[model samples]
Target: MPTTTGMKGGGYYDANSKEQRSASDAFLPWLEEAIAALPEPASHQQSWNFLDIGSSEGANAIYTMNRLVEIVRRQSDLPVWALFDDLPTNDFNQMFLNLFPASTPALSATDVYTAAIGGSAFGRLVPPQSLHLATTFNAIGFYETRPAARLPHFILAMHPNPGAPREGVEVSTSELIPFQKQAHQDLCHFYAARAAELVPGGKLLVQVFGRNETQSTGHGLMDVLNDALLDFVEADMLPRSFYEAFVFPAYYRNIDELMAPIREEPELAAAYRIEHAESRDVPVPFNTAFASTGDRETWSHSYISFLRAFSEPVLTAALPQDLPQENTIEKIYQRMERLLIDHPERYEFHFISIAALLTRL
Candidate 1:
């Protein structure tokens, strides 16, 4: 299976981004502070440009942008131009529709303008020295390309195989190191690109998935899906070839990996200052609600729906074109639903997120 580069479907992401919404809401105070700290534009004529990188469907963007506009209005009457950037395949139409509802006036009758810029966030999406502030939420984990290593066949072998030794059940360093290196390189390029686009005193706030210093590299959902796929292989429901060849582009970095370039590279160090960096465990709300209510069926449906919304497109793209896409996808989700129903406790996994505030110098 060839590696896919960008997130294609918008509806799934929009529907399943509760974790993203929570994370963004948690980071709003920092966003407001960062925006407030930005040096005023040289003159009143200069419009405030706020760029939202990896903005999908504008659900979270709407809330963030509104708060930003409110803050900027208090300081100055200058026009605010909000740029929303994402892959070309993103659901931009839906984003615009949500942002500019017919019943509501745009930006509360303030001079706030919204536009979409479609492209990869890993590359340059705006002009040099154009933005006053930039924000990315639950994005930037996606690398531009997949690592050279093939997807491991026995990804879930560590889950107590009854007779097997636990010592050798881990994903080896050989399988993980290459991807870590790639992720580090991708972030360096991303920072460098943003460094060029931002003004000297501009600020950037980013929130992304992260692991603790001791935690190993891997995504929670990816782990669950790996096990689910392996189960399919065991039951002869999915081809082993497809399972081995599948690769997810998402790569989460530890705090050290995330800040490595800024700390070591002279150019980055000189161009960007790491104002604040912190990690927190972001709980899955559905799981929390489930734990209190003990509703297995509702909890299972909610958790599986979230997973299916985000992973369906990627999994679908990995399959051969000749497959009956709709039926196959439904079957896959059906199996996933059964897995969650059987093991309701699996929904309690908390996503670890790292948020950083950077200033361009």
Candidate 2:
């Protein structure tokens, strides 16, 4: 197993990210308007560039990039150069396989050329003032580096995190300052980097899994994993240190954190003009399917698969070196699947997000 940093690659992420797609779908209208409002290019301009940052398995990335390509086609015959960027640990080969023109016959004669780059989205990757339109979906909540927060026993740093492995080991809001500051810094870098790459009047659509007034993504369901793993530690099946050490290297930003850069940082404030911003809940496909059909087996599998797609790599990296890697990973997820299948109410993954459309100034 590779010590990777992002989503599980080699086709796993491609198949299981329906919830992400649904989130992107909610922004479809914003996408269309943003594309429609593109400023006319100078007479010397040669072609257009469309970039999707943090594009995991290329499925959702391709969906949006293809749409951008299609809409641009209606406006002109300029060839489109599409770029997908993510962490080097991500599965680039799998991304390319799905992005190839042959694999997507509909895009064959569209004069769209696709390429992938591996790097931090918080860092500059392309030439300054070069891109026409750029986007990121269901990303940017990830911490550039996991904060040294003092969550002694939990899967995440969110409020209402599980208290287990040790009674009275609760993390107070004040104790989570490192995580809060880290998120602010990450967002600062993210906007600044993207600002340097986008041209004047370019549209930047950023939609990320985050916190709203009532709901926060990765909260309740993460608690389920916590309780199940705490059981493992109690039974001596896994060490307590694993629970103490494992925390998702992410922070779900509330609206305040989302706008911190704009309010506090001059670089971000002077670089772009915000066109639209929102924070709301989006429907989860598996959850919706269960609500309508009450299919425990199918919904449980889909829910667990979706979880495993993104979390498996990080969870695997947290395992003790002596354990059988594959077997232990399977056991952990298998246990969660059984838990969800038996008590559907135990699993609550609310899909809430903060999205915005900004134009480069």
Candidate 3:
């Protein structure tokens, strides 16, 4: 009955502690823009608290606080406050504490707490009607699927390397994926609860990752990496231990698969009127600016970094059990490098970052 999807290996947010912070920096402007789009409270000049849910490493929280303070200072008001909350496992508390030392007061008052969201079990991280604005950047959606075409490949990816047998690892290709229904349900549930917590007419901005219905570019790259992973696992390139401990749950959902949970919550669905769903072509190197850059190599590297960051679980699960487990980060990096080198023509790396905005009813 845990609230999270119970994904094994590291969840996307858990991978490469360094990368989590980096990604947050990249997301800051988009997030600030999203927040700015929200209908301001009746007392826009009055200080109000903003909540950053699922805040990883609290970078977005810090960045958001900084921006909010700037906006408020223009009017000569007290600085805004921010609360950064995430599941205990996210380990963002210590990371942010280190980044913004306690002795150093923020431009606005800031606090961080451990909390799980989007589940049947709710944590009282923020009181009802207490927050003027709430947001989650790219980490709120933990979804699943049961597609026949993808399941087989996913099952192979789930096969643990030899000698590492656990119940979770004993996944059957014949059985459907676990926790799909519950995870989706929890997401919607959390969305609704978050809506209720917002002050009446308060804004909730969720910058979740999504796919373009019109194009297959994002889905295609995910399929390629996942399919290649399946081949590697089935070929015994990776041991069973690796799959069970790491890969099966990563890259487990296509865009549709992941969003299924969010779209199901009627209350959460009704609480917001979607204002915009925008898709911007984020070139390969993932220009932090994303607007000015057009270099192909930069685009390629950006895509590669994304594949590595977003597909952490998949890579870990496909690792051969026979390999040294803990010291395998560099080894896995080498493996990916070899794959790209081995099949230069087979790889096509391109991606887009999708953004959505919704208003709290």
Candidate 4:
């Protein structure tokens, strides 16, 4: 049998990650271009190695991997072996099952090999100088672990967008730095690890839910979740300490923030050449549906489902160990559903993403 749940957050992130899927779709051209630009495999190499870290159950991950193998087939005859990786808790059976007879039009060839590796991206999981190309899509916003400091003000590290109208909520800039610093170190470490694993001319494409000039990918969703947490607290359903200790470990960085280390830090600067980098506003299907149909119930359900998919695991973990974690989580999501269904106007969600293509220098 395969390891754990395919998609973390209880197999919820994949179906509800419409925003992430949109980001990958929007960034596909760049991904294609990056694949085309990869250096030819060395004469000593046996196969072209490709990897997707933080791929949740190979949902979007499989789609992109199929395309990658297809592109490489057009350019090289070398056998392609793809590695799909995520936390050990992630369900990998679906990813393995989907490897053959690719979801894409091409690359149905039998020569391609597929496998799953379970681990966090922060550690080295591959051999030295083995990978030819690597990609992580709509992931990496999450830290391996949360900072020890309490986020008493909000559930997420960054502030909710001002355009989002949640009255009486004050965001603390003081709370942002620890997470930002940790994220930077984490990214730098990730690059260093990849640099060691990738051949000199190997390529990496990274697309993540990210920040822009005005707001972040998480802007309004976090706001609603924040309010819901407080409501639970006020209702005596959750402990004050739970609220204080909980901060979404994810940090969505702007393109500038993403580039800081690759452009400035001596080690990363030397290891990678920035091939492509851009921040974009990706479409949200529920938001678009809400705008088009004026159907609050459908939209609210979609919205809350998306919220629970990514946020539920951490939220459930925040509860006291003795608490009925699953039941409590369900109730909290129920409240979240109501909150959005009743006042869909106030909680607006927009998906923002940043994508970059890098070359191992």
Candidate 5:
């Protein structure tokens, strides 16, 4: 299985993160309300700390930071310290470039100060009891590493047959248990880390992909891409070994799974209280645009571009280091685009996001 890393290409993510932006926008109203409800900080403190975890390319970060500044200023004129955190390899340059454009002046407004911190959110990214409010969107699903239960086949066990293990094979129930356990542990760790960093009464708002007991969360996007891969394998256009070995390092947790850690663990329960937790349906923007314009080709391109932006790095890393990296990546996306164009109805689906607001005790 491939290890979790930063997003693949900065340019693609910057351009194709409309879905992420929409999700963030949806949560803004709730965030604004929460900020308004927060107790005023100590009089001695001159600034408030706002941290944005996994701020991919600053597309949403720009809006989030600006909105936060607006809300915080309502209570006080104190300057706000906005910090953006992500993996070390993340495109910090692009993030800052977009955040503060060349034509505009620096983000040195007397009311808000901006800085980028490169690190993983799984660990201590900031000083303990320093941050007042924390926000993460569409990034919590990426665990620190792949689970120990290594399925030689796909990243997720979605195949029909559960008992057998072959190239591109299904995983049995016994084999899949480790992944679930690992996910629970990963979430607990993330909460613990954030709990340590946040001050008493601090609030954390998280927007991540989720599913209920009877649903699959990628909104059928992963299934469609999986089918495209299966077609390439059958046609011998790509090696079966390569296809089987490729695993995307992400896991979508349901509402129960997300709350389990806090509910079951004494320390986590004591440290945090769930203020609001619910699932929301996130419609696909590419599908909406296609519906309005009636352009299948543009929709396919946009959908493929979004997927490729996130998947390319993981897929490329999974391939053998000795293999030539010429047009191999392009071909995979090309085939995926063709599959979507052939069946446009597959694009019509909604992604479920579990939005939770937790306050430190």
Candidate 6:
């Protein structure tokens, strides 16, 4: 229920179609490039291991595993272990197994590390000095805001927000701040600790949504929905804190915002360098059919759905009194359809984004 000034996190959406796949496709080449920047194997006998943190659905992890298998199979017969780590509640383990079911005997073996890394006070999920390569693709921005600023009614306006109590809601900032600050502190600690875990020559490749002095946010399905949320609030359909709780969590940091966390840690300051930090231009196509209307019901539904996909956790945690848990999905759908039909052009159909790639120290 905490509130930061900008987007909180990435990769918290329920994209059932090929949309997530498409974004991954766009990310693969840059990932390959980042991996290439790592120190090369001195010999075919060199061993390597890969880990993905905050691995929501494990698409990127699987992709990286498959790619590595291909590379090693062609170059050397070295054994490689690929691990996908995330919260225990993350429902991606079975899906990841389903994706790489063959259990290839030659190239790599898959392992699942289901732990709540974010919940840890220190955020050290992987054991120290064990990992060789790690990649986190766009899932690090889920931050909590200042505890005092949470609101209850904002939940009603968040598009796609699925889980929340529909009854009367109330939250005290005092109750929310400690937990959120701990989470944020732990997250930063994780990157710093992970940097320590890596071998001297080992590399940690991070492809996160970041900014470069532009007024833009991040990328992907959630970004589009967040943009819509900003619109709804500005039009007076939703409260201002609604934007603070839900919309701000999904944004990317500018060059300074991206570097501030890492720079604060002296251990990482010397080891880490901006290996490749630049804002990227990502063109995204939003659902324009819903944007051209002013209908409250239609817009409400869209807003709820968007919130469910991107900001549900914050809304639920911060505004439990107003957002009941009963029949939430039905209400959200009804609200979205009403909003979309009312203003088909109320939202942007397509837009471009800025991104960054941070390499190991």
* Number of the top lDDT candidate: 2
RMSD of 2: 2.6
- Measured on C-alpha atoms, candidate 4 has an lDDT of 0.78
Which ranges of candidate 5 are over 4 A from the true structure? 103-109, 157-171, 322-325
Query: Candidate 4, clashing residue pairs?
Result: 5-90, 5-91, 6-91
Q: RMSD (Cα, Å) of candidate 1? A: 3.4
Count the clashes in each prediction. Answer: 0, 0, 20, 3, 0, 64
Q: Write the per-residue lDDT of candidate 6 for residues 141-214, one digit (tens) a residue.
A: 55533333443333221222122222233335454454445434645665677776675556666555544443
Model 4 residue 107 CA deviation in Å? 6.4
Which structure is stronger by TM-score: 5 or 6?
A: 5
How do the predictions measure up, each by TM-score? 0.90, 0.93, 0.63, 0.92, 0.91, 0.63
Question: Candidates' lDDT values, in order?
Answer: 0.73, 0.80, 0.48, 0.78, 0.76, 0.47
Ranked by TM-score, the better of candidates 1 and 6 is: 1
The predicted structure with the larger lDDT, 3 or 4, is 4
Residues forming the 10-long window of minimal summed lDDT in candidate 3: 112-121
Task: Encode model 5's per-residue lDDT on 146-167: one tens digit a residue.
Answer: 7655665555643322222235
The deviation in Å at residue 179 for candidate 5 is: 1.3
- The regions of model 2 sitting more than 4 angstroms off are 1-4, 101-106, 161-169, 324-326
Worst 10 residues of 4 by lDDT: 1-10
State how far residue 185 of model 4 sits from its true place (Å): 0.6
> Model 5 Cα displacement at 117 (Å)?
0.9
The model with the greatest TM-score is: 2
